[model samples]
Target: MSISDAKVDVVKDLKSEDAKWVKIQKVFYKDPNGKARDWEFASRQTRVEGSELDGVGILAILEKPTGPEVLLQRQFRPPVNGVVIEFPAGLLDKNETAEQCAERELLEETGYIGKAFSSSPIAFCDPGFCNTNLKLVQVSIDLNDPRNVNPKQQLEDGEFIENFTVPLKEFPEKLEALVSAGYILDARVQNIAAGIIVARKYSL
Candidate 1:
């Protein structure tokens, strides 16, 4: 089934015990003036010991004669109740580094096997609402590679993602078009487009 047909029937609060990936808690802390305060926030429950990262986002770049094409996907996000465009991403497996997780997730979600070279520092997503942190990994995909020709996705059960590519230079314009077409852009996806705009404007 396509994400366009996905629907949510009801929404309800879930207890921390019933949650498999995340939990909510109110943390009490002392402010600068010794004032006691409590902050309610959500955090992941599956972090590997000694690891500060929760997940990795793959910034896959396909080498094309025209220009670099960024791999992106569209999926139904229950929180937003809409088909959202986002980069291929997933939580880290046991003992998996950010680069390793990025490569695995990229192949699973998009069917393109690529090599990860660089990664961003741990970046928090909606720090005010959750303690989820992830790294943006840059992966290089050589379309001329024999394996990349007609690659097939290996999504897990319940995953329904549609992958597509947009030229890097035209990503911002594509984002505008997608927004006008009633598709939600994930915050990280939007930020990448904004970064492209700023970089071009400043000749970076």
Candidate 2:
């Protein structure tokens, strides 16, 4: 379903005084050595539509005459209290496949329709801190495609995202530039940037 057709409602509010989307809990478990261990972790109480995965990150590439460019986004993140440089991403809707989520999120967050070329295995975002995880989907965009000539984003209420593109060859430099400008780099984007560097060095 399109973003406009999707329904997101606050069925109930069970948040703590210091919580919004997450809740913290402590658990005790036995380790491999049979030693008792206790740890605290945070979990999302919000309902997700599809797989239990947290969301999807898109490695969207646009084919341009000059070179292939990767799409990126700049958005203010409350956790960091600063802007972040990240790939277009969003949580999956109920019953939505990874590819479907990737496509929909790309359009919703970046105003670009993309075709999924490949997807990475489901991976954890921060196993030490949370159970949240996501799939990294590689997507392809044709700049000449008429559907993209004047694309428009379909962001949700209170969402503020700015999209931009950097040539694949300059992706690493762009990342450094963003860091120099005080933008936090999302781990998924950092990994993609590293891959780009490795591909160039080895002529992949």
Candidate 3:
């Protein structure tokens, strides 16, 4: 059959009322093999949905005037059932742009606000599920700016984060170790790598 001849046979809303952020729709495709084929070939369905989100992420790199020293955070992630060292990141709510989300997440997780430089969205940031895309925001922070850090606003309920600054020259090696040690998951690792690439390329 030609691609243009394809047609959707069914669609159902599978999202629960409690899932406010996304609306899930189950889509079914017609099977040309009919019922004679195995059960697996009978038909296919999936919950497809869109969210009220624009993607954003932080490359929250803290630098000292003399070189070296980059800010970073180690936080507990219940989904992984452990603590992981990662950059601050989150989604942009409705009516918010990617840049706005990046700034918000950085401050909320690191207690510091620096200049935020944004990059274009990358699909590699989210590969497993959800159409949500992400962009890198490089936050150039002033350690002496008291107005820049707010621990009270640095975290949300149920989140435990430890903030620290590491040497810029040591970041690549440290990231490699973290990945090799299985301390870094797919998305976080990919984002950090992308951030480094962008930072180097753009000199941001």
Candidate 4:
């Protein structure tokens, strides 16, 4: 799990007045099996004008005939080349709390207004390259209400999704299949799913 000879050599010093997704020069140093390998990478860095806010959202939903029901969305992400089942997530608007973002995304994506049981700070999705971070929110649903099963409204211009429910015990299998199919390439999501599995197993 350790990357050897990991070094960043700045090629160009970027300015803050640049537009989003500004390119900065970077040289990557890699020592593979004691051999020196140098690769130049054009790193992108941008100045986010707005204040940084925690992006909190729900994940690892579950549902059953009698037990607690959870919500999940099958997201059609073009970047990944297909649909991957995942929980509803969104960035917190400026001045908004992580809990508020979690509730908003849950309702907007899956049309469910459930309560967040536990939430995590906005952790780095990938520290090596991207500055994107996500706040992990754990939510418990109220299945007694019929509105929880309603169709969700897709807000993103081209967001195509399918909402579905499954028992908590079956989440790992679905996640595994998504990984096998190359839809879930983000390691952060995998790590979140592992934590979810531990949570559900202990709850039951």
What ranges in model 3 sit over 4 Å off?
Answer: 1-53, 122-124, 149-153, 179-182, 190-204
Candidate 2: segments with Cα more than 4 A from true spot: 1-20, 47-50, 201-204
Pairs that collide, model 1: none
- Against the correct fold, how does model 4 do in TM-score? 0.65
The Cα error of candidate 1 at residue 113, in Å, is 1.1
**Over all chains combined, what TM-score does candidate 3 have?**
0.62
Query: Against the true structure, what is each candidate's TM-score?
Result: 0.97, 0.86, 0.62, 0.65
Residue 7 accuracy (lDDT) in model 1? 79
Lowest-scoring 10 consecutive residues by lDDT in candidate 2? 1-10
Give lDDT tens digits, candidate 1, residues 31-116. 99999999999999988888999999889999999999999999999989999999999999888889999999988888898999
lDDT of 3 by residue, 1-204 (tens): 322233345556544453555543444455686634222111112212344345666766665677856666666564455556766777666666667778777777776776786565564443333445566666777766788644455566756666666677667667777668755444554555567778887998
Best TM-score among the predictions, by candidate number: 1
Please give the lDDT score at residue 176 for candidate 1: 97
* TM-score for predicted model 1 compared with the true structure: 0.97
lDDT of 3 at 61: 62
What are the runs in model 1 whose C-alpha is more than 4 Å off? none
Would you give me the overall lDDT of model 4?
Answer: 0.61
Compute the lDDT of residue 186 as modeled in candidate 4. 44
User: What tens digits encode model 4's per-residue C-alpha lDDT throughout 1-204?
Assistant: 211122344446556346365344455565757766655433334222374543654763544466654566666554445555666777667666777778777777767767777877657765555556677888766666687666467467745556766555565676687668755434545665687888887994
